[model samples]
Target: MQKRKHWNLGAKLAVAAAPFALLALLSISLTLWVSWQLDGGAAAVNEAGRMRMQAYRMSLLVAAGERTLLPDARSEFERSLALLSHGDPERPLFMPRDEDIRSRFDAVGQHWRQYSKHWLDVRPADNRGLREETARFTGRIDALVAGIEAHMSRWTALLNLMQLATMALAVIGATVLLYIGYLFVLEPVGQLKQALERIQQGDLGTRVERNSSDEFGTLADGFNDMADQIQAMYRNLEAKVSAKTAELQEKRERLEALYEVTSLIATARSLEELARGFVGYVARAVHADGVALRWSDEANRRYVLIASQGLPAYMTDGERCLRADECHCGAPNAPPFARVIPIQALEKEGLQYCSEAGFETLVSVPVRLKDRLMGEVDLFFHAEVDLSPSARSLLEALATHLASGMENLRLNALQHEAAVSQERNFLANELHDSIAQSLAFMKMQVEMMRTSLSAHDETGTRAVLDELDAGLRESTGDVRELLLHFRTRTNSEDIEAALQATLRKFEHQSGVRTTLTLREQGLPLPPDLQIQVLHIVQEALSNVRKHARAGHVWLDVQQQPQWRIEVRDDGRGFETGDGPPDETHVGLHIMQERAARIGARIEVFSTPGKGTSVVLTLPASDPTLLDLPPLQAVS
Candidate 1:
């Protein structure tokens, strides 16, 4: 069944007023009706009394034989009687309550008419007959008067009853009005004040007892429902705020950890060191029991454990290296992200690495550089861990950072290796160009001397022996100069000072007038590049002294838009095709190789019987940037 809605304020007021209104209306209507009845009865009684006066006047006039007065009185009495029987415009006859009053009015009207007819026929001469007629008419008028008197009395009694009814109705109206005021207005107002006080006291649980079906009841219920909803909302909002604050705090910690890890990785000098820092910091940041990193040693075809921390020694002792099919690191079937696994699950799958290592959970992330997988990092936990998506994303980012940093370190190391290899090749070429050529010349001279001795030409043998001695001394001097070149450093002076020193040494050694020009002053190069430049300059000067057969050389180091090194000689220059199999041209080739290693270009300009110029020009390199691996191949 459907329940009715509570009455609104207007409806409550109307309900309270309705009974009073109805009683008041009934009382007013009864009183008005009773007063109307009394007025009609009193008017009829007055007309009857007036008719009695006119009837007495008519009798006096007839006894005096005044015919004119007789007609006037008779007409007036008859008119009053007619009006009582029927109705007049001014005073209409009343409808009686019963047949007795109506019949009395009819009898008075009939007797008066009969008396009027007889009095009109008889005359002033028949006084006795007139007197008899008057007596009979007077008697009827008296009866009529009595009836009017009784009618007035009855109407008066009815008016009194109506007055009592009015009083009773008024009493009912007053009682109902008082009850309405108490229940609807006064009582509800008191309850509302109590409700307000409770609300002011912060008691949201306060609820009014809904006893009446009115607006106040609805108001109380509404307030209660609103309070409940508000309280629930407040609680829910508080919980959400607390949870959000916790989440933000956690994010702040993670960000701080990442910042520290980034700084550590940046300063780490080697891949192993970087991996150790990365794993340690990541484990501490996200809270893990242990971390182990493995790198693939491709040349050895095995995984080498590069970094391990917070793990049992037994796990890393003999297990530092793993073959392809022996580890659970997706060696052949690589997953894209870190694979989280329970130790029990791994044990079930016959992968006992985590289980034997005494870890309950294991997570492995494969380090990659683009398409190639480099290694895998394994994270272990002593307790169960459910990886959230956010956690997994953070782990993936960490893995990416490790892989990129390690790869950069490896590349740097490889660059150093290449630099060393290049230097070795250059030195071997230098040996062939200077010392080896001298030795070959000595061997040829001895062979020639032996041929002369066999033919008995002593002059030819003596000349060849002299040449051989000079060659030995020149080779010895070349070796000493090579040692000096190694000792030249910029610790005490800049490149310009070093260049001037090298020119002075060349002038002393070869008796060549060496001059150096600076195109842009304060030209700078890194220590390693400076060493390479010095060695190349030494080789060029040695060539000028030993083979150019000239007296002067010029060294021009310039910075236009970039750096350029030029060594010029005013001596006999070799042709492009002079050295067979590139043997005599080996010095030029080695210079070009050195230039190429440092991302520079070497240009050789020469004409036979004129001069030779070797120039290495490099793009402008920023001195402020820290670039590439350590180069120590100047030897």
Candidate 2:
């Protein structure tokens, strides 16, 4: 459809005032014309009255026999008649166009001509007759003046009438203009304002009416279009906000479930505890009817149920263990990614447990760490379950946590076993170095004594017996020292206090004077490091008592940029090519192993006669010891 043509605001206002404008122009034109006509009217009356005086003067001049003065009077009277006929525009003098005024003016002119010719020019013998003619002439002049005055009065009245009519039309035009403005501009503007207010008050449906083909009409259409767009945008915004709110709520639930599972992983001590907690939380998180967690062997040949929730007793017992081909849930043929399986489909493959238990669907999430599929989490539901991508991802994340927890527990068990084996080897080394060597020497001495008895040498036999007694006494001391070392414990955390106690015990037992000097200047060692240091000190002390044969021993500990401990004895020292071999002195070997465990170095210094010193030096910063690996058993 073609659009209708419309005037803009400026055009509309101009059109409305057109008639009044024209009326004003017409009234002004008429007033100017009437005033121009009246302008000359007074001058005509004055000129005519002067002519009457001139006519009376001529009659006087004729009667006085003054011919020269009479000529001047006649010229003056005739000039007045010409002025009244032609009108003097400069003096603003003019005769009216009315025929009565014209005729009266002409009669005055004719009377003046006759009186001048007969009485003044010809000198009439009777002065009374000339005076009478002059009198009639003046009367004619009076009538002409009256005619001019009447004409001016009528023009003036018409001017007043034009002005009054103009004013009345102006008032009417203004009233009509105001009415039109209200209908087109003010009323439409007010409607738009009301609609805007309603829209502000949340009423999106408000609109304006298009009442005319003008600016106001265009404005009304725009307003309605704007309202429509706003309403549509508002509706779309509400929908998006609702969708976001629901998404946020779902994420919050997932986070809560993950937190619960994390707490279980942190505090749980065994795989059983972790799996049980995990299945319960997973069932609640995914709204499943039942959940089962299972572990797969390295060959992927069998599955073992670790924990289960909301499962029937019969189903749990029957499916407690499954070979690779026994059940689809535990089968190696299942895909690595998390999946949904129907119980009826499983039943078609000869797995009747789920169908018998009335489960319609099963969600099996593979528990994996990197590429290793360690286990599976099976969720059972009576109704078929459709999981969203986020829900599926959440399930997979829970499976990963389960896998990590299981792996951690396995590593912990392996570390405990290794520690036990390491301790056992240490005991064997100690016994072999000390007690076993002493027993071998005693056995050889017993053989020497029997040989001497057979030879019947009294001095040799007596000396062999003395030697055997000494060997027995030395072996007894070794056994007691081994027992002491084995039973030793670091009851206090303070390394200084533990060392002090060890020194006092060594002095009392071995009957040796000992001095302990500790100079501390750095942070205390970690408990594991401290234990290793203390054990090395005790072993050094044990060696001193058994072999040093010293009168006094000094144990010095310095804690600073590095930790250093020196066990020095004033004993008949052993000869050193680098020091005694570890095979011969097992205490030295044990101390070296303990030092290596804490990332420390051990050194032995000895002289044939002066003394022997065993020094253990540990660096303050040992990155290898920061995250120490599990101790490997050594024999």
TM-score of each: 0.53, 0.65
Spell out the clash pairs found in candidate 1: none
Per-model CA lDDT versus the true structure: 0.75, 0.81
Off by over 4 Å in 2: 1-194, 202-246, 345-347, 439-527, 547-553, 559-561, 569-586, 596-600, 606-611, 619-628, 631-635
What would the per-residue lDDT of candidate 1 be over residues 1-635, giving only the tens digit for each residue?
89887677788778778877877787788778767776776777778778878887877876777777776777787788667766553554554465676777677778777776666646634667766777777777677667767777877787788788778878877887778788777887787779779877877666677777667777778877877886787779988999999889878867877787678768889766787788888887778899888887654257788888888887787668887657565363567787887776554643465687778888888777777778888888988898888778778777777778887788887888887886666667767766788798889888998999999998888898898889889789978876686577876426888888988988888788988888875546777777777877877777677677787798988776677888899888878556412255246676676677667787777788888888877757763242534555463
* RMSD of candidates 1 onward, in order: 12.4, 9.2
For residues 334-433, what per-residue lDDT tens digits would candidate 2 score against the true structure?
A: 7777888877655376457888899999888888888887878989999987889999999988888888888888888888887778767777877787
Error of 2 at 631 (Å): 4.6
What local lDDT score does residue 523 receive in model 2, on the 0 to 100 scale?
69
* Candidate 1 regions with alpha-carbon error over 4 angstroms: 1-242, 260-265, 296-304, 321-331, 345-353, 356-358, 445-468, 484-498, 507-514, 520-536, 547-554, 561-632
